[model samples]
Target: METLETLSDKLDTTGDIQSIVRTMKALSAVSIRQYEQAADAVASYAKTIDMGLTAILHDRRAGGLSLPHTGSTDADVAGLIVIGSDRGLCGRYNETVARAAVDCINDRTAVLGVIGARAAARLEAQRHKADRLFLLPGSVAGMTPMVGRVIVEIESWMRERGVETVNVVHNRREGRSRAVPTSSAVLPIASEDLQQLADARWPGPGLPFFRMDRDRLLSWLVRERLFVLLYRALAEALASEHATRLAAMQSAERNIKERREDLTSDYRRKRQETITREMLDVISGFEAVSGSDD
Candidate 1:
């Protein structure tokens, strides 16, 4: 049985919480839009890179030049990159990605790299240690440098550590507000995919020609391809994070509204009871006074 004052205090506290939740919801919505736009922009750039790679490969095949092998077939070491969120309040966004990374390990000797603090903590809780930890970019503008750093790390792993295969695990935006955890192999550009690109009809009337060395051109195209893939992953992961947060905040807002309604009802009922008790006391006193006078 709480007093009226206590009930009033609870109502006020709930109102403040509701305001905060609404603010968070608005911020999340804005962030999701920006990140989704970034993802779209990067996707267009990726298509351009793919076209360039296709032209180079087509020319080489026509000239009887051997296609350079992009990925190693007989390597023992593996590299794993896990992208997640640094902040919480996103309903297991970080934990889900960490779990996916763990499942992707598959008993291989892996050099693991983590991109978010919260995600790294989750992985550590599962008795897994990361070889390197990279901070997640706070905004779309900051992602380029972050991706560059990741590329350097990947190169180091392959060049210095003899890592042959590289894989990335993250949550990708599925629909308007849903995220699905997925894993993609980043290294060893799949031969089948390359062949498909090379075999496709050229979009233009004439095939473009380049004077640069074929192998050098292929290497450059491959690097750009990696950058495009990494950038797109980061953008999608960030968008998914904001979508999850928006959903969580919406749920919190609903709960807070219900609680506030219940508290208001209780306050009104108690106040009415108090008023009735006071009225009864006044009436009884008047009756006693009249009897005394008589």
Candidate 2:
């Protein structure tokens, strides 16, 4: 029902919107690459930390090495760190992580530590109060400071809440462009993993002697393990965040293309009708003049 001029104006507006979507899509692609690289780099560091922990655990079985705030057997409280995104363009990214965190509560007495404003809002909407709220780092370069802040906040929570265990709920990268919500426990390091580390065979020619006290060495290794675990979680979450954005943007781009094509078709049809009507008007006017001359 639109006139030719109206349709033409709408087409121009649609074109502008399409251009904006394309720009966002391009930005998402770049962000995905940057986060992917950061995740990969952190992965290597995590492996090195794992190897060191394996060696330390194997050598110190008799030293009574203990981790501070590891929680006594009677401790029943849990602390959860939920990682999500601050932005909303990515479809269901924050909701998926928030749901995972909620499921993890499972009637346990829990203290929630949330990262990202969008995530905190989702949990708060579900009637969960965050004991610690943190903003996600803007880039890979800022992860170190972010991790440091998380460490301090978590330690404080452990002491104040008498937390028995710590868990992280986040979106983990599955492949190049896919991610899935995942939950992992950090405190009371899984018995299976500890046993594996304890029983692991040393790759070198012989057992190496440590210059430091066994307890000190174990404490340092335990702290490093904890840091690496949290760091890896953050990295995975960041990478997954970007991947979701990229996928969402790609989908939006497709929708935009379809809409633009529809608008173009409509514009053409309207213009054609206008042209036909104008031609008919001209011919009728000429006929009237010819009749007057006759």
Candidate 3:
């Protein structure tokens, strides 16, 4: 009621800001749950495949697969896959990944395949051409198929372009930018890289002994293993994005709460001061009138 001109403005501004923070928090929560689910699925699949791969290698007897060329090979022509968020408000999620990707490609003359538009923009800003720009779906579930497809495409690219080295540029769930982790992939059907694939596991108890042509089985196992790896990397990247967004939203909400509380306190104090000053003025005026009368 006191003529504190800014009181209404403060409430309006703080209310709007608080609502924005709340919305962000809710969106982040949804994303976190989604990422967690995807991560679980991919992790389980990878574990099973790893077991299978190990078994197959063990059965090979003569070191699984042989290395064709000598140990030494030409330096890698890297293929960078940088994953980032499609939506903003997750503080620095895209920026950090972009920075890491840029740093990686700069180190080696390589082709970059940017996974998100924001990341692509960052790459362009650095005056780098992303060999490919792939779009991510709104949901992580939509990502599995895309990742599988990407692996197939990347395989072809690496083979045709003679790119032996490939790595994933992605953020970690722990909110740390791991910079650039360069990974050499199984390419050119290298005896070395094929050997790198863990051997397939023995069928579980109660499962009838599966008979198959060993060579065909090996081929199937190799391709499936590659797809599994690609899926895992993509899932992990997606999980990190969701986790980062959740953390950022929570921080923003906390800041908004603090700001609102401060504003409320300020408004109340100013109102109280105005009331006190009016009372004082009224009392002094009465005293002055009485003194004039006397």
- Top candidate on TM-score is 1
Candidates 1 and 3: which is better by TM-score?
1
Top-lDDT structure, candidate number: 1
lDDT (CA) per prediction: 0.88, 0.80, 0.66
- Residue 226 deviation, candidate 3, in Å? 2.7
Model 2 lDDT per residue over 81-103, tens place:
99998887888888888998888
RMSD of each: 2.0, 2.7, 4.9
Question: How many clashing residue pairs appear in each of the predictions shown?
Answer: 0, 0, 12
Considering lDDT, which of the candidate structures 1 and 3 is the better prediction for this target? 1
Per-residue C-alpha lDDT of model 3 across residues 1-294, encoded as one tens digit per residue: 534677768778879987877787677667766766776776777666556555555555454454233112345565667776666766677778777767666455567787888878877888876788888777776876787777877777666865665667776565342223233343334455445653333457522233776556666665676676666666666667766666766777788788888778888899899899999999999999999999
lDDT of 1 by residue, 1-294 (tens): 898899999999999999999999999999999988998998998999989988988888888876668876445788889998899899988878988888987656469998998999999999888889999988889999999999999999888888878889999988877888988877878878888888888899978978888788888889888898888888889999999999999989999999999999999999999899889999999999999999
Q: How well does candidate 2 score on lDDT at residue 40?
A: 73
| Model 2 spans with C-alpha error above 4 angstroms | 62-74, 175-178, 207-213
Q: After superposition, how far is residue 59 of candidate 1 from its true place, in Å?
A: 2.4
Q: What is the TM-score of candidate 2?
A: 0.88
What ordering of candidates by TM-score runs from best to worst?
1, 2, 3
